[model samples]
Target chain A: MNVTDLCGLAPPEPLERILVWLDAAEPDEVATFRLPHVPYPLFDHLTLRPCCWDTTEQADGTALVRIVRQ
Target chain B: MINPEFSLPLAVPLRFFRTAPLWLLLAGVLFLLEPSTVLSSRHAPEALALTHALMLGFAGNIMLGALLQVAAVVAGVRAARAGLAGLMVWLGLQLGVALLVAGLWFMQPLLLQGAALSLSLTLLPLAGWLFVRLCRSPACDPTSTGLAFSVLALVTTVLLGSALVLVLTRGAALPFAALLRQHVLWGSAGWAGMLLTSVAVTVVPMFLVTPPWPAKLVRLLVPGTFLLLLAMLCWPVLMPLLVLPAAALVLPLWRLLQQSKRCVDPARWLWAWGGLNLLLVFGLSPWQAEDGILDAVVLGGQFLLGGLLPIFTAMLGKIIPFLLWLDYRRQRPLAGPLRHMGQLFPERWLKYLGWLALVAGLCWPWGGVAATAAGGVLLVYALLLLGMLRQACCKAVAALVV
Candidate 1:
């Protein structure tokens, strides 16, 4: 749910970049990111167990992310 | 503690998802078996029948079914009396669509009346229920906003469609072309496209590991597209340009997909095929600038590849496996190797299906023998998908029962 937890998962560089973006995503709009390979459990966690966000997939394997920070 | 509340039974959504391919196959058969009737004229009764199978039967069914999930998950709302509502809405939709297709194909007044009556009995209340839930949901993000508008467009699409049906019944020789254009504009662009855009903002990123649609585009794109479509009502020239922007969205996403690291995924390729089809719809605009059979072919390909089928293919890869996994996890109670979405239906098969879809898409508008060939390929694609899902269901059931 937090960046430190994501750091603990040690996602590859591509995914880490998405996490970094998610940290700074603007409100009420989508921020799409892509991964080279199917990511680890941490990416799945962010998708299914979003703390204050929603995750979607594009036609390709790119990730379209939106966060709702309280 | 992001424990999302499960709303409708997976059965409700799965039933609709599962039925989708069958209807499309029926569409293919209708298209193939009556190619002369269907390919010869855009206004042919047989042609309309083929379209209905795709529109009301295939696209509408999937969208409505997926709507329950989107409403529950994204909008923080649920269908009222989920079980009964699901059944009533599904039944009404299937029957109404069937009658309308029949009425149009045969030009039967009674069937048209029955179609209108069936939809009146079912679509209005169901749409209203969904509309209320979506409008009232606390989620105020772009996806939810787009969804709320999409539902409104659905209401308009249905009413306009009903009016057309009524016109058919009255035995009046009115210039229904304008009304028909309006109806298609709202139905596909306003309702279907809007909802697709809404879902894309959510599902595309989560599943494909892709970037979200730019917030500004998500905000301005959907509503702006719908309004422009509305403007096209008085100005028919707007027709060619309507879906161009929505389709243009693919190029940037295609660039992003080039950056995706998902090495073994077929979704990226399928999506690319879809985007290419959208581009082609406009790119080949000069061949049949006006509304001719060639133009119909281009539009048909856009809806099939760019619009509905590609997304359906991508979502099936996500949803069916997820549903089965959820059941396996919840119902098994014993320790076993749970299947990932990839394991249940491997990426290779998706790749194969993707190829078939591409071939079928190309063949779809060629007419005559080529159109039949497209149907053959599409039939295989649909059967493969449905068969895989059916196998997964059986496995899930076996696990649950034991």
Candidate 2:
């Protein structure tokens, strides 16, 4: 699935869940499913895929997470 | 909702250390000097210098630093360069203020204009940038909204400030006096007024353990105040038009007090009393007597800055201790948590000081002796606060060491 499919997921919390689904997909298929908008640095660092979510998503999300880069 | 304890961020502590004392000192000096020349002469240099001292030196620095720290914490945006930005702003502001004051005292209009313009220009972008970042933050609350309004006020402050400079330096063929009046109105009512109101809404309720006030007051009053101020700017001829908006803006605080839970937080009580008294003093002056305007202005300044601001300082006297205790307790949960808030500062002393200052201000209208007594009482209060701050710092240091 492309980033657009992920965008359609609507909320940030569910998007994390969807990332798991994508990760569980065949490696080749998952490799082909690029998150177009996410920076490569962030995409590579994430266990699944990273998405650019807005403030409304942040306010509505269940958990707060901070991504630390090494 | 997140634990209110953890809601306040680390930057706040740093800001408190840096900015709070400076404000107190400026407030003290203004109280002592009683610059009759500045007040009566309408000398641009004297008036502008005093204005900048209060606005930029005392109120602006504290508010800017505190707002940045609070906004970052509340908005959950780790300011990428807050430390450096803060330092730069502080240094530039201080240097600019020193030069501006010197220029004004010496009657060097060029230097005054240059310093004022430089200070405003340097700080404006930082304030604007900070506000934009805050707007993008995930957590937007009443405090944040109040801060956002303050930022807008800062912008207007800069624009009018620069205009004042141009008029002073080049003898610009514009209505300089008209512009100066507008600048004062916007700076005093828009910038200082809004920030103080916002702080009151968030802090008074928190300290009082009061039920949450409706956010509508903040939402309506902040923007409404700005819009009205903007309207006044457009029609300078309608100077009297300001009275309606100012009263309307102050109405929410009256309502908030009616609904406040802890009627006994001596500091908050004094603040409510002083604020209402000043409002009435100013509100009624238009009808009763023209000569009372100066007295009203002085009394209003005392109430707002002297009375209301100190209430917050006293509140901080409690808050800082509690925060220090919490910070320590987090490290060692069983170390016999630091003394209760009551033990940290002398509440009775604060109450006495508050009463003395209020009484003196009220009586000053009758006799100069009362005004002198008020100044002395205020000086004592300032020294007391300094002593408490020093003690708190020592305790905090001990906690860190242990």
Instruction: DockQ for candidate 2, please give it.
Output: 0.03
Name model 1 segments beyond 4 Å from true. Answer: A1-70, B1-6, B172-174, B282-293, B305-307, B332-336, B399-402
- Candidate 1 structure quality by residue, lDDT tens digits, B298-345: 466456655467767876776677656554544443334553555456
TM-score leader: 1
Interface RMSD after interface superposition, each candidate: 10.8, 16.6
Quote each prediction's TM-score.
Answer: 0.81, 0.72
- Cα displacement (Å) at residue B323, model 2: 4.9
**What is the lDDT, from 0 to 100, of the residue B338 in candidate 2?**
48
Best by lDDT: 1
Worst-scoring 10-residue span by lDDT in model 2 chain B: B1-10
For candidate 2, the per-residue lDDT at B261 reads: 60
lDDT by residue for model 2 (B1-402), tens: 221222233344445444545544554465457645444434545544555565566556566645654554445433455566666666677777767766765668778776876687677887778688668754456666777887888788778777877777777788886776677666766777777666665555445544445556656767777777788787755545545544654565556656666566566566666566546544543343323435534544454445445545544644555555444444443334344455445567567656755665565444245555554555565566666667765776676565
Instruction: For residue B267, give model 2's deviation from the true position in Å.
Output: 2.0
Off by over 4 Å in 2: A1-70, B1-39, B42-48, B237-263, B281-290, B293-308, B311-315, B322-336, B356-360, B363-369
